[model samples]
Target: MDNPVGMDNKPIARTNFGSNFKIIPTNDQIKELQTVIRDRSTSRSDFVFNADRLIRLVVEEGLNSLPYGDMDIITPTGETYNGLKFLKGNCGVSIVRSGEAMEQGLRDCCRSIRIGKILIQSDEDTHEARVLYAKFPEDIADRKVLLMYPIMSTGNTVIKAIKVLKDHHVKESNIILLNLFCTPSAVSMVTKAFPLMIVHTTEVHPVAPNHFGQKYFGTD
Candidate 1:
């Protein structure tokens, strides 16, 4: 497969990870992100609102990749109908702080869905991500997991999170990454490390913002 052209007009690497790697095809999503990034005057509330909207789309795209089974149903007209039903037993696990931003979107998509959290921060000196904390459901091994992380820069944090999931017995093929933006390098690194995993995102950027979380949260 040919690499897709990103905003910088550079070729973004394509992954052999699986059929689940998806980029939401929506100009509106791009527009919203541009508004959030280019408008330095954008208030924190407004930025969060636009970001959440985009996150909802990413979450929906991720959920669509989950396993589904066809079933026969009866409609209001008492006619037999054929429909596809999502397989039950799915869960969301988010890398804390930035990743938590996508959790509400997941809940909106699937009410009462089980959610887990992992806190992984980068070491200031080494710049490597290390898991500080993790909390997951006991039956996580049996459920399909949607790993939420808003940005994929070096792919270090995400890789660590995936390792934690694997340690908890989550199957590699059953894990899907829901991200807002990802760099080509990050995408390649992640797919190469876990070829069976899926990655779903709104856009692919050539580079990540220097202080994405800080800027968005008005902490910078």
Candidate 2:
């Protein structure tokens, strides 16, 4: 896939993050993303519906980043077919309310995949993120993890979440961050902090608007 071009007219690959990041490359995916962004100006229901569609695209892209193994399957016609299967041990970890929005998309893509939750909130004054609660599959350390968070603006929350995963013995390389939108600052911070981690997103905005979640949830 070709590198995503940022609003500044530069390739996303020039951000110094190396190959640890991927942006949805298809025109159809980009078109859907634009539709979701536009729906933000309409009713909440419209925004949610479109947002879910975009999330599904990103989740599917994230799943593609996971390791897969080859297998032989018997088709209905009794013919041998070679197929690829996701590694056995895998799970999804949502970063909380906003992240939970992507759970359905994850489930739709990976049937019966285990899900974990981590609640983190940023301090109003300090802007630092703190984990309020976290739950993960007991075998998460051995499973490839998809860390779900719709927006990565400051990256502090993602950093904290990764720390929590590390505390649980989940290797950095095994974690894939699935996001819908992000800023260059956020990408820089995340990739610098965790070079081995992979970040998959539908778009990278030059600047992350403060009202994204509020607008989507109709609280703005």
Candidate 3:
């Protein structure tokens, strides 16, 4: 981890940790994915296939951090072994449109995972977003939530989403922001705003012109 200067002229570690924000990707993995995605010659289909695989890997990585307790188990060779169990069930919520692309991977990785939806649109004038629709199970407060939104170039939408979850009593630590792409500025924004929420992004670009930049491989 490295330190960046802040308004107070003090050193700040470059990671976000709080009740709701956590970043999941390492610099190496993110760079590899970015190289593949940025290749103009890459076929759209192939690009998507690889992206989906990468997303699955990220989901699995995040799951490994959840609370787990060891239990005695017998191996196939009749040897004693230890295993872990999920402390609680989890929920997956997508930020609509592009987020839908990630649902399949999350579903495939988690058994009978509950899916939630949040629809947010940006205002043409203020550049702020309004949540047009949202529906999450009443039990979401108790479950670990996986929030998905692709290409987080700007932190506005995701920040609003976190606020909504908090208002509903969901702890920031229980929320994980899953995505395929993000910018350094956006990462800094979310990490600074909601340090506890883990962010699992496949790639980090320098800074995108808009929330959805031209090079971003997303469904606008």
- Which residue segments of model 1 deviate by more than 4 Å? 1-7, 13-20, 26-29, 215-218
Q: Write the per-residue lDDT of candidate 3 for residues 75-181, one digit (tens) a residue.
A: 98999987887777688898876777778888887768888999889877786978888899898889888888777867788988888888888998888888766
- Cα error, residue 28 of model 3, in Å, equals 7.5
Identify the candidate with maximal lDDT.
Answer: 2
Report the C-alpha lDDT of model 1 over 1-220, residue by residue, as the tens digit. Answer: 2345677677665655356567777586566675685477877787777777888878888888889999999998999998998898899999988888788899998998999999998987786998899999899999999999988888899999999999999999989899887787888788889988888876667766545577666787
Give the top-scoring candidate (TM-score): 2
Q: What is the full ranking by lDDT, best candidate first?
A: 2, 1, 3
Clash count for each candidate, listed in order shown:
0, 0, 16
Per-residue lDDT of 127 in model 1: 67
lDDT over C-alpha atoms for residue 186 of model 2: 87
Measured with C-alpha atoms, the lDDT of residue 211 in candidate 2 is 57
Model 1 lDDT on a 0 to 1 scale: 0.82
lDDT at residue 130 of model 2 (Cα atoms): 90
Whichever of 1 and 3 has more lDDT, that candidate is 1
Write down the worst ten-residue block by lDDT for model 1. Answer: 12-21
- Which model, 1 or 3, shows the larger TM-score? 1
Model 2, stretches more than 4 Å misplaced?
Answer: 1-13, 26-29, 38-40
Compose the digit string of candidate 2's lDDT tens values, residues 1-220: 6565577757766467668887778587577665566553567777777788888889988988889999999999999999998779999999987888889999998889999999999998887999999999998999999999998888999999999999999999999999988888888889999999999987666766455577666777
Rank by TM-score (best first): 2, 1, 3
Question: At residue 125, what lDDT does model 2 achieve?
Answer: 83
